[model samples]
Target: MPVLSGAEPFAHDGSEDIGVLLCHGFTSTPQSMRAWGEHLAAEGCTVRCPRLPGHGTRWQDLNQTAWRDWYDTVDAEFDELRGRCRSVFVFGQSMGGTLALRLAQQHPDIAGIVLVNPSVTTLRRAARLLPVLCRVVPAASGITGDIAKPDGFELAYDRLPLRAMASLQQLWRVVRGELGQVRQPLLLFRSNTDHVVEPVNSAIVLDEVRSSDLTEVVLTDSFHVATLDHDAPTVFSGSVEFLQRIHRERAEEVV
Candidate 1:
C-alpha cells in the first residue's frame, strides 16, 4: 500500500497551546482536509491531519483493514495532542466525523468538536446487503469527488472495497447509538446538496447529541466534499469562529 503523492499526512506546530486534530473521510486521504488544516494552522492553532491506515494508499489494502484500525490511529493522535496542548479539539468529515464523535464520547474533557457532512447511516439501499455482499465481491465503484469545485479530486482509490465499507457500517451503528453520550460543544456544517451522504444523518445526530453548545450551519452551494468545494471558506472561517467562541466561554467560566 504505497501512499500517493498528495495523500500524505500533514502536521503543523502552531504557536498556540490549542491543538486541532483533523480527520478525513473514508476512502479519502489527508489531502481532502489539507486546506482546512492549513487554514487553522495560519490562525496559530496546532493542527495534525493523519492519513488513516490503508487510506492514501490502495483500496485493496483497505479491504484487509477494519474500522478499528482507523479509530486507533486517530485515537492515538488525539492522546498525543492531549499530552502536549493545553486544549485540544477535533474536526472530522464524513466517516471521520463518526470517529470524532466516538472520541468525544470516550473523552468528555475534549475542548469541542467540529464535523462536516458526517455520515452515520446508509442512504443507499445496497449498503444493507454489505455483510453478505462483501463475501461475493471485493470491490465496487467509488463515490468520491462529489464536489462542485472544478477539477477537485479526492486523491482516493477509484475502487471501493466492500469489506472495508461493511466495517464502516458497523462503526456507524456504534457511534449512532452513543450519540447521546456526547457532551462537548459541537459545531456541524451540512451541505445542502451533498451527493454522498443524506441530510437525515445530520438531523439524527442533532437530535441525539446532548451538547448544550451546539451549532449547525447549512452550506447552500456545496456538495459532500464541502471542505474542497465552493463553500470551503465557510467551513474554514466558521471553524475558527467556533473555536474562538468556545475558548472564550471556557475562559469566562474560569473567571
Candidate 2:
C-alpha cells in the first residue's frame, strides 16, 4: 500500500549542537510529532522524527511488523543524533513515549526526556483478550484522532491491528520492568481528558523512575494528541525551556 500523503519522516540539522529525537505512537506516523519537531528545529535544535516501521502505511503492513522492528528504527535514529550532537533529548507521544523510555534505559547519556501522554499500560479489560482476538479477528476499531481541537487530524491507520497491539503490550511490560533505570531529567505533559493513554500510565512512571529532576504538567483541555491540540504551544514552549535548562545544568556540571 502506498504510504499516506503526509506521513513521511522528517529531519532538520540546526546550528545548535543539541539534538532532539521525536517519536509518535503505535499505528501512528511522524505527522503526529511534526509540530513539536518543527518547533524545536525553529529554535536552532537538530531534530529527527522517523517514520516507525509498519506505521504510516496500510494497517495490514502494521500487522506484519512488531516492536523490535519499530524500536530498531528509532534506535538507529538515536545513534545518528548521538554521533553528531553534543547532547540529545527524546520527545514522544503515546507509545512513542514507551520507546523513548526504552532508549533512555539503553543509553543513559541522553540529556532528558519530554513526553505527551505516553502509554505504558492499559487497564482496559478488553486488552486481556487480545491473544484470542488476534486469531479470531485481525483487527478492531483504531484509536486515533483524539485531539480536542476542532477538525484536528491524526494521520494514522484506521484499523487497530491486533497483532501489532500485542507486540506493543510486550514493549510496555518490558519497559515497565526497566523503568527504574531511566534516570534522565524528565518533563511529561499529560492531557486531562485523554481518550488514549490514561493517568495510571503517568503514575507508574512517576512512581518507578529514579529521575530526581522530574516535572509533570497537566493539560486541562487537550486530549491524547496534545502536540496538535490547543495546548501545543504549552508543550512546544515547555520543551524548549526544558532542553535549555538541561543544557545549562549539564554545562555547569562540567565546571
lDDT of each: 0.93, 0.92
* Number of colliding residue pairs in each model: 0, 0
TM-score of each: 0.98, 0.98
Q: Estimate the lDDT of model 2.
A: 0.92
Which digits, one per residue and each the tens of the lDDT, describe model 2 over residues 1-255? 677989999999995569999989999899988988888999999999999988887998999999999899999999999999988999999999999999999999999999889899999999999877887788899898998999789999889999989999999999999999999999999999998887999999988999999999999979999988999999999999999989889988999
Worst 10 residues of 1 by lDDT: 149-158
